[model samples]
Structure formats: C-alpha cells, structure tokens
Target: MHHEAFVTATFKNLKPNDVEFRMSRSSPGRYALHEFMKNVYDLKVTDGNGNALDVSRPDPYSWKVNHHDGTIKVSYILFGNMGDGTYSQIDETHAHLNMPATFMYMPNLQNQGIEVTFNVRDDLKWKVATQLKHVDGNTYYAKDLQYFMDSPTEISNYSVRSFDVDGQTINFVLHHNGTEAELDAYFEKVKKIVLQEQKVYGELPSYDYGTYTFLACYVLNASGDGMEHRNSTIITSTTSLANGGMDGNIGTVAHEFFHCWNVERIRPQSLEPFKFDQVNMSGELWFAEGFTSYFDDLSLCRAGLISQEAYIKGLIGTFNYVWNSPGRQFFNPIEMSYQAPFVDAARSVDPVNRVNTFVSYYSYGSMLGLALDLSLRENGLNLDDFMKMMWTRFGKHEQPYTVTDLHNTLNAYAGKDFGDYFFNHYIYKNEMPDMKRLLNNVGVSLTQDQNNVSFGATIVHGIISQNTIMGSSAYKAGLDNGDKIIKIGDTVINDSVDVNSIWNTYQPNDQVPIVFERFGKTQETTVVLQASNVYNLSLFETNNLALDKKKQKMRDAWLQTKK
Candidate 1:
C-alpha cells in the first residue's frame, strides 16, 4: 500500500541568518551508506507564522533556508516500505520508524534537546513504543540529536511483556498477528538469553533510563534484521512467532542484545562518535561484530535453550568458512574489517569477485573467537574473564578501545607470550590457531575427508552457481562461475542429474573428460578429481571413544551455565 510518514521539523531561535537541515546518510549499528535522502520528497519550508520560506539545496542531503525568518518548519513526506533495523516503513498496519530514515534535523543543533509527538492512528488503535523518555500523551523527550537519532519508534497495536532484572527493566514489544500465548512463550526464552548474557559480563550495562527495549516488528511486510542501540534494539522479520520464527528469529534477538555490552558499551574507538552524514568504517569489526556473533549462539547453549549438539554443529559453518577462505592471503583481520564499507549492506549494480577476495568479518572474527576461547581454556582461563576484564577497563569506564588495547588487555589477562602469539600470528597476520588441538582438549575431534573425491563448485540445475574455489578440483579443470556442465565423463548433467552421485563413482586422483557451456559456447576439458577437503567435527564418544575426566571436565566448564 502507500507507505509514508509525514515529518514536520520545527526549528526556532536560529543563531545565524541561515540553517541547514539534513537527512542522515548513515545510521548506527551499520557500516554502510544508505543515502536516506532519496526517500524524502515533497519538501516545503515555511516560517513559524505560516509563511513559505526560501529553501535551497547546497548538497544532495542538505536543505539550506537562507535569508529567512529565524523560525522555520520543514515538512516532507518520507516514503519507506522496507521495515528493518536501518530503514522505516509506514502503512495502515503499523508505522515502523528508524530515526535516520524518518526525520530531518538542524546540522548545528545536534547537541540541543528534542521532543517528538507521534500522532498515532487511533482508528487502528495504534500506540507508540520507543526507548526515549516518555513525556506525556504520545510524546517523548531525548537529551540531544544523538540520542534522538538513536531511538527508534514503533507505532502499532502491539503487545508488551516486561520483567525486572538487577533493578533494570527489560521490555519486549511485539507487533505481529500472533497470540498472547505465543508471545509469552517467546518472552520466556528471551529471559533466559538475557540472564545468560548477563552472566558473561557478570552484570548488565547501566541503561541510560533504567530500561532497555526490544522493538520487534514481525509482520509479513517487514524485512529481516537486528540492529543494536544504546538502550534498545530494532528486530524486524517477515516470519511470525508461530511459523518457526520462535526458533529462527531468536538468534537475532540474542545477537542484538549482546551488543549492548560489546559494541554499544565496550566501545570501539573508530566508532566512538558515530557519524550520521557519512559512511562509518571501522577496522575492529572483526572483534566488534564477529565476537558478538560468537556469543550469540554460545549464549543460547549456555542458557540451555538449545542442545549441545546443535551448538557444536553451529561451529562447523563459521569454522570451515573462515579457515577455507582464500581472502586471508591478502588481508588480515584488521584489513578484512576495513571491507565493511563495501560489504556491510552496501548496494551496487556491478559484479564483484567477493568469493575469492573477501571474508566476512562476522565469520572470520567468530572463528577467531572460538580459537581464542579454546586457547584460553588451555591456559586454565576462559574468554568470559577476558570480556569481563574488557568491560571493567574499557566498557564500564566508557573508554573507547583500540586494537592495541585489546592486545594489551589479552596480554594482561592471559600472558605476554600468549597474547603476543595470538595477535602476531592470528590477529595481525590472518593466520589461524591450532583449533584442532584446542577443540580436542574438550573431546571434539576435527578431521578432513581427504580420501573422498572433491568437486569444489556448487552446481544447481547443471549450472555452476558460484566461482570455483582456488586449488579445488573444479578450479584445476579451469571451471569458473556460470559454466554449465552438459556432461561429465559418461554422465550427462541436467536438472535430474545428481552431481554428487556422479562424483561418488570416482576416486581421488581420477581424471575424466568434461563438456560444459561457457558464454554461449561449448567447450571440452579433462578434470582431475582431487582429495576432498571437507572437514568433519565429531565428539570423541560419538566415534565410540570415551572422553577422559580431564577433557570431560573442560567441556562441562566451557558449556555449562555460570549460575
């Protein structure tokens, strides 16, 4: 339907003859350029006395009112349809507003206090929910533009669930077509995640207003995402709580909540003062986002909401993804993190060779986190203590930390030698730790399926879906992305053909003739089958071996609940 939010920015007491009102090009919790100005239209500037004023655009995102009365009311229509953490959406069902996407503000008045009153749709029985301080009616107050922009609002006929933990209130507001029973069930697990994450840092961040809100819009029209703020987070998805969303979307809730401690308070120096007018890139995203990703599922396991098998299985994806990546040959963790501006939800029409050139900071850092945690456990310590130390020295004091601070802190907590080795080899050099030995300390065995045949390209309907991995069998055969194999040896590849079954008939080091389509031309080549590079992770007892007391105790201590 027609999705739009009418905004009226009333600016008064102008210090000079002109005022610049701008729509933010960036938002918090993300590292991409959104250019929110594109969605704003029908802009009309007028005086407080209801007289039209002269407005000029000096830049694409800014509107300058020159030689005008001090009082100016800038009104515009913000057309938003994508309901996620970074954008806004308004419809007859609800008005989900992420601040930067819905509001315009005076450039010089960032430090000035602000108040907004949401004129809700009484016909739909809509109400306002936000992290901003409630004034009266449907109005709210923010200390400054920074706080104002950070506070996202949801207006709908939503349900609320609240609980007090450590004298701080946690609110869960759900906008969905689900039953109250479903909400109650979901909130119960949310409580477990909250308490378990709290156990990690030994406490919660002192929320600015003694409350933290989870603004969740699970309507069919919403997009899927989770973004963390100082005292709140916005989690939107198209999946309803009754439709497998309870299991699927809970991970995002856990992930965003952890950020209140890690990225939000345990501040990264590069993102200390978040920029609104430009893209913000930080080299510590490997630690900022990746480490939080590690804790997201780990928290679920520690809370007993998920089984140990599922938790261990979760490690396989990030582990193989990070370890198998060829991007490490070029960029270290810090350098890989610098790619956030290009990869963090950045939009482009051109094709990119990301498969071979890039590794996600999320997966890269998460595997590193797994490695560091296991390594720390080997030294009779744990990652939890290191995080706690981080909170005490940096987060609690609100001192923004750099990469060196992280290294020095690890050195102080683990040891000079241990920290130096982790940083020099793993962090700075893009090398991986001995994860196999570290995981084996807890009775999990890591092995490679080298005896099996390997074809390192994903094929769907006789077409290669992605770029072939370097050094893989397909790559050795000169196969690249978009090559459609018509026949491999005697097996004709098609929609009905199973590539795996064909590969099963072959042995490692076997060579076969292949015919494929490339750029509208048929080609012939001989492909040499290589040893499978697949890595398998299994528990010692799963392989019919009993864990020793030492390893069993270590596993229990690592996975068990703190309290």
Candidate 2:
C-alpha cells in the first residue's frame, strides 16, 4: 500500500477574502476527535491563474487564506493507512476513503454544493463506488457538504454485484482476492439480509437517487469495521470470503443494513447535525447502536442464513458480558452511551479501569432488546410492531427523536404503564429485566455453569492480565493486573502446559497459598476461590426439559421469517 493520496479542493465565488479551510477532527459514525491534520502536510495554495497565495495558520487544524481573489485552490498530501469506517487508507490494493479523514472543507460554505472528480490510478485500474450522484465517468456531485461527508468512496480494482429490490439498486462492491463464486455466494446472503431488514420496518427507507451501496473491502490491509451512513455503508474486514469471512462478516452486513432505518433515518435528535470539530456525544446510542446490535443476528436468523440454535448460541457472549458486569451499578444505558467518545474504538495509552467501570452499550442494549422482545411477546405483541411504530413516527419523515419521544412512542405501541416501568427501571436505573423468566417463556433455558469458577483475571504466560473482577477471591487475595503468578496452590506455573487446567484442579470455596510477582517483587497470599457467575443458554428440548407446544410456537414466531 502506498498509504498516501494527493488531494485538491477549489472554492470559487468567495464572498470573503480571509476564508477558513480546515480538516475535520471527527467523522460521521464516530464520536472521538481525530487529529486529521497530523497526517496532512505538503500543503500549497494557489489562485485561479496558478499564482501562489499567502496563507496563515491560526490553529493547528485550520488555515486562513487572505489577500486572495474570488477563487482559490488548495492541494495537499493526505496520509492515511488505517482502512476502516472512521479513517481513510490509500494503498496499492485500494483507496478506502472516509471523507472527514480524507478531505478538507470550507467551514463557512456548509451549504455550498460539491463536485469531486477522483483521479484514478490508471495502472491500478481503479474504479469508484460511492453514494454520490454521478456526474460523469470519474466525477460525482453532492448537493451539500453533509451528504458529501457521509458518502464514503472506494476506488480500487474491485468486483461489483448489484441487484434491484423495491425499485431501488443495491450494490455490493468487493475488493478481495477471492473467486467469483465466493463473491456470488456472499452477495446472495447479503441480498437476503436486505429483504429481511425491510420486513422489520415494513419497508425500506427512500434512498436518495433510488440507490443504496455497500462498499466492502475484505482484504488483508483493511481494518474490521462497519459504519452506517444515510444511503450507504462501509464494511471493511481483513478476512476474505473464503477465509471464514463468508460466515463471520455477514453479521456486520446485517447490522449496518438495519441502520438505514434505525440510526440513519430513525435518527437521534442529539446527533442530527454531526459536528466535526470536537467529540459528539449522545445518550440515545443505547437505542441507535444497541438496538441495531440486537437485530443484527436476529435479522440473519429471520433471513434463514443461520440456524436458530446458532442464533441462540450467539447471544451467549454479549448476554453474559452485559448480565455479569458490575459497571451497571455506576451508569444506566444512557450514561454508558455518553461514554462513547472515550470507548468507541478510541483509547488512551495510559492504563484505565474500564474493566470494572464500563459495559458496552452494544451488548447492554442487545440484552435489553432481547428482554423487550420477549416481554412484548408475552403480551401477544412483538418488537417488530414497536419498531414499525417507531419507523412511522420518527423515521418516515426524517424527524429526529428524544428519550421522551421514544418513551411516548413505546407507550402508544405497548402501553403507558408498561413503557414507564421499562424506562424507569431499565433505562433510568440499572436493574435487569426478568430475562430468566422471559427466556423460559419461549422454551429457552438460562443457567449458570456448574463447573465454572472465578479466577478473577485472564492469565497469559504465568502473568495476570486484564483487570481482576471486583470482589473476586483473587481481589481479596490482593492480586491485581500485571501480577505474575509464579505458583498457584503450590503448582508451579509452566509455559508449555495449560494454566487453566492446573487452576481447574481446585474446586470452588477452596483456599490455597498463592505466590505472585508485581513490580519485580515476589509476594505470597492465601486465596479463596468463588463460583463463576457465567451462565449458559439452551433450548428446553436440548436440555431434555418438557416444553409445551405453545412455547415452541412462540419460539418459531420469534425467530422465523417475517416475510
């Protein structure tokens, strides 16, 4: 990968001479402030006649151009190596362009239309795939800067498989070194996901220009990310279709596809105008992102691309994470959502206590979605009806919604008392729902693992890694992160053998002497063990528990195809 791009922008008919052109610090679908200007250098500004124009930097991100004519052209070298939803990557394989990280704009000219012509590398044989309206062969038009920033462009020697659905074109552009058959197989599943998500909302959003595009780069150089936009989505992964990605990458496809109706159009009022100068935070990400996470796998299940058992098993990871975390004592779903700026793919070098303090809104909200789905099913209704109601109230006309609006909509769909109780206990506070009873209602079982014991922390090569769980026996023994467990209960730690097997030799509530090293100092303590809180899920039939046919019918309706 070359990892660099030559960018140019021309602003004509300027009303002011001292115009400010700057790089955005944030991008669509991201909440962190990126120092995009750090990757920008070799900048040169000129007039219409190709004369040099004087420019001054008032801040690190913005450049002020004074004593200029009505027109000024800005060109620079943009270095991008990270290929994901939030950042751009230019390489010999492809140019994965995320606009805020790639382009510079005139802040004052927010309403001005944009015409971009990508100069494709002829030797690379690159072509353009973007949601922007095509003007000519390589040129495209954006009605405004918002649309332009939202439209991510993928230019590479890529293969495309397109289909027509509901009078709209859906394009899947793949840049992978895979066979044509692999692309066809993957695209087939992609098509099924599209239709199934449409069934959730009862219809597809009216995509601009009658088109929606999925710009996918499944190559070795790209990062694994899936970001949603207005009429398009960018899904990048390092795994190719043949290398476990055929099944692994479909969940991202389903998730981002659901966003076209949920977060993309069924919008959050706080995130309506995404500011690029600083971090943008919203309390409603539990709904915008969490609910989408909940539906990602469910949509695939409804599409018949995955089995019900597979879907049920898939919930185990996220469900356990949310249900077992102690972070809920500090924040509700909304408060945890506001922490996106620090946690959403953004982290600091210094060590922090997110292990004890944070729970991902994605997992938390997915479990909540699961709870709501089953709770509604108990009342002879379903989440689809609530979502369809939300779609009509907030999505169809593109009206953004607040927390009260969501509560009111739920009230209108389910009931006032039901909505208030759910909001008060689950959204405002941190109490979990009757997940055990709810799952049992649909013939699913939730039980803690009998053989599992709490080791407090994950271990790697005789060293204690990650934050030890609070109130765990290991914590009571004063073991912490970075402690090297030289011996556990008189068993010498060995690099070759599995340490977990040695730990499993001892049962829960047993106490033994432990030796560890921290900061190069050896220490000794007697540690008491505790049972792990981790749980398991299985169908009643799988567990040999008697299940009535009515519960089977309920399970079928929950996971079966809606269309």
Candidate 3:
C-alpha cells in the first residue's frame, strides 16, 4: 500500500476467487481536494512473490478493484457514494449514480489533466458505459480531469448504443434502458441530425465530440442540462424514446453539440476562465445556453423533423413560461447565471429568491437570445452572419470575454451599439417584452384569444400557496392559494395528478371545463386550452422567446433558407 494524499493502493496478494470492495464514499467532495475520487483505489493481484496480474474497477454501485492474488486477496474501495438525493433512477432498485463531489478542485491549483481508468469483472452483468473514451477490454479513459471533475456524474448507465459520426465514434450513454433495436434506431436518428449541424457550423473542429442522453420517465418532471468542454459536453435529461420524439431527441443533441462552436469556443467572460471555487457569472449566459437551447430544437425543425406549427407551439410554450415567471422580476439573467452554484443548493426556497438569488441562465438567457436574434433579423443582418462574425472575432481567439468585452464584441460584429437595449429590457426592467413586433418581420404573429383564453394557468402537486407559481395561468385564473384541483373534465385526480391525460384529451384552441375548490366553494371554469405544453408541440415545454426564435433561427440558418 502506498500512503499518499490521493490514496493510491497496489495489491500484493493474489487469489482466483471473486472479491468485492466497498469505499467509504464515491465522490471527491467527501474526500480531500487534489485527489480524484475514482483514483482512490487500485489493485494488482500477484502470486506469493507479488509479480504481475490483472486489475479492474467494476460496477456503478461500488468500485471493485480486481486482481489475481495467491491464496490471499487484497482490494480497497476507491470512492464512497454521496447518497441517493441528486441522482436520477432507472427503476426503483437502480438509481443514476451522480458524482457531483468529483467536480471539487484543489485550492489555488490548476488541474492540467487527470486520468481515471476502470476495469470490470468479466462476468459482471452490470453494463459499463461513460462519456470517456473506451479502451480495449473493460478499461476506459476519462480524457480531461477538469471536465471529468466538473461533471463527475456526467457518465451514464450501459443501456445505450454506440455509433460513428463523421469519422468520429459516438456513444449514447442512457440512464434508462431501451431495447437494442430501439437504441440503434435512436442513435441513427441522432447521428444524422448532428451531422447536419456540423455542416451548418462549417466543420467539427474539435478532435473529440461526445454526447450523453438521460431518459426521464415523467416527461415534465425532469429537467434538461448541458455544459460544454473542449472536446465534449455533459447533457443531462429525463428525455427518452417515449416522451421526446425523433425531432426532440436529435434536436437536443445538435444544440449541445453546436456549443463546440458558439458557447464552448466563443465563450462569455465569466464562463471561459471558469473559477472552480466560486460561482461564474456572465451577462452572456443567454448567448451560451439560450442560443444553444434555441438551436437544439430549431436544428431539427430546419432538418424537417418537425413542422412549422409544431415549432411555433414549442415557442409559445417557452414564452408562456418566461412571461409567467415572477422570478424574472426578482433577479435578472446575469445575476442568476453568476450565482448558479449557491442558488442551486437545497436551501433555495422562494421560486424567485434562491439561497442565492439566481435565475437559470438557460431560461432567461434564451429569452434574451430570442430578442437579440429578432433585432438582428430586423436590421437585415441574420443570425448566420452574426454567428460567423462572433466566431471570427471571439471564437477564433479561444478565450473568455468579460461584460464590457461581450458588449464590445457584439457591437463590433453587429456594427452598432446593441448592448444598451438588451441591458435595459432584459437586465433591468420587468415590462412584458413585445414579442409580436419582433416576430412580425419573420412572419410570426403573437396574440391572445380570450375565447380560447388559456388564463395561462398551470397545475401543481398540491394546493399549497408556495407550490403555485405567482404569475401562472392557475394564479391568474383567480385560484386561491389553497385551492385544489379535484377534477379535470370528468377525470378525478388523486395520488398526484396526470396533467397529460387531462390536457392531451383536448385539441389546440379547444375549451376544457376544469373544477377546483377552496373555502368549501367548488367553482367551475371553462378554460380555452390554447396551445399548452403538449407533444403536439413536442414533449418538452419551455418559456423563453429567445429560445423559441433561437430554435427557429437556427433552423433557418442551418438550412440556409430565408424566413
């Protein structure tokens, strides 16, 4: 055994029998910094003389460092499990192993690189897969230690398939299992969409580009996440074959992959030189995530995977979300993006006020992206040219931009003073943005139909005041803080409700009569079910216009078609 800060171990004993090792923890957060949690254990089984033998780290539940020892055997647990809260679950028995702790960095030191290798028991049934490169046999190599640490839970279960894209191999590591045929079909669809995105972006310049998909069972209950790196991106979701269709899945892949150009390469000021120890904020998160999120869905639409109506419906969903959020008033996208680390903590209670007051850079940022795109389009400069200019000016430099730098860079690209408007409307004010005027030039119109009045209400698990979003359709419909939805149409809701079964039964612009009660008074209201968060618009629901326009603009830009 070698005693070191990283906790490396060498096994001297050798045995032919099977052995299992358990670590006190499975993440770096629980251990000392400067040490990767996955590297905390190593085993090499030898004869009585301690010669050479094979070693392996098998299974997701625990890292089993294996080797052939003599009559005796020796193994140590590499990392301990952080427990079951933050991770997702495939079944009741198996949960997605999240390694948030692994993102911990050593104080005041830059990590040039780190290596984590894993080998499993040959006969083990547990499937082994990751975003890392697969070496021969059971071994795998995580290329960038900083990135691996940034997203330790970035890996997924072994229920996905592997395919090739543009001479580079690709793998879809999923949290949920689908049949081999099903997975193969999905991978093919994803490959085609990604290839199309690469063509639009000119070329896939990075030496490596990786993709990961997480299947969330309850379509809306799960959220989507994406972060870019030099050669890969960590995308987390509950998206599956069942909920998101070909367009949704492939579009998500393209969006994150495109970040290799937009966000990953020509990055914002705060995100470029990422401070591992603190919250990294940039007023430009809207460009980073919003633009990416907008493109993710739009790329597919441009590829003809979805119709114009479907695309519009999706945008409407996102707009409704953004328009209805009270949090937008509390914190602007810039502050929210900067305070992501603390705001994401469990203590964040108010929908608006976080443990740290922060908004999702993706959600609010995307809204700004929509506004920016429309502005560009109106001025006779399309997003494609803007993207090319940004790439040429900022992306080629391969460096981060500060707030002033972001404004100056955009000004240089657009040849105008564009920062003030974005700052005034998105960063400071809470007035409803006039999206109709923006989309007019692009031939899209926004309007309200009181006859098809949506009242823009949404449902919740309970009638708890805190659970009800302040500006949602439910709140706008005069539903009291403690009112409960006992029934939707003819269906009685119990044990949590099925929003889909109730909503999907109607058509767009269809009216649905809903009943809820408060203070012993049962009231019935006929709500015109305008386009809601439905599969008719795709499985995912959003509330950002920039995200919507970004999607549409990305589609148009990728296809080189005029709106």
Once model 1 is optimally superposed onto the true structure by TM-score, how far is the C-alpha of residue 494 displaced, in angstroms? 1.7
* Backbone clash count for every predicted candidate, in the order shown: 0, 1, 26
lDDT of 1: 0.91
lDDT of 1 by residue, 1-563 (tens): 59978888898888657779999999998898999999999999888788998878899999887866678888999999988999999999899999998999887999989999999999999999999999999999999988999999999999999999999999999999999999999999999999999999999999988999999999899999999999999999999989989998999999999999999999899996889998767889999999999999999988888887778877887778788887888899999999998988888998887888899999899888989999999989999999999999999978999999999999999999999999999988988878789999999989998778888899999999998988788888899999999999998887888889999999999999999999999999898998877678878888887899999999998988779
Write the residue-wise lDDT of candidate 3 on 1-563 in tens digits: 12111222232232445544333222211111222234444443343455554545564323332444443233333343222223322322222333333222222123434344443324434454444456665444554444554333322234655565555655566554445666667767666666666655555554443443322221223445444445544445556566664335565566667777777677775564453333444556656766777766666666566666576667776775565566677776666565544434334444542312334666666666677777776666656566666677777667665556656656776764665565566665544456766765455556653332333444567353443445445544465556777777787867567765566566665656668887888888655455443212222123333445654554355333233
Q: Give all TM-scores, in the order shown.
A: 0.98, 0.98, 0.62
lDDT by candidate, in order shown = 0.91, 0.90, 0.51
Which portions of model 3 miss their true places by more than 4 Å?
A: 1-113, 125-176, 208-229, 234-248, 272-277, 342-359, 418-433, 451-480, 483-563
- lDDT string, candidate 2, 1-563, tens digits: 46889999999998755799999998888877777898999999998889999999899999998877789899999999998998999989888899999999998898889999999988999999999999999999999889999999999999999999879999899999999999999999999999988988888889999999999999998999999999999999999999899999999999999999999899999897988788778989899899999999999999999998889999999888998787998899999999999998886899988888899988888888999999999999999889999999999999999988989998888899999999999998999988899999999999997566787778899888888877888888889998998888768887986877876888888897989988989999988888878888988888899999899899999999886
RMSD of candidate 1 to the truth, in angstroms, is 1.2
Candidate 2 clashing pairs?
Answer: 1-92
Off by over 4 Å in 2: none
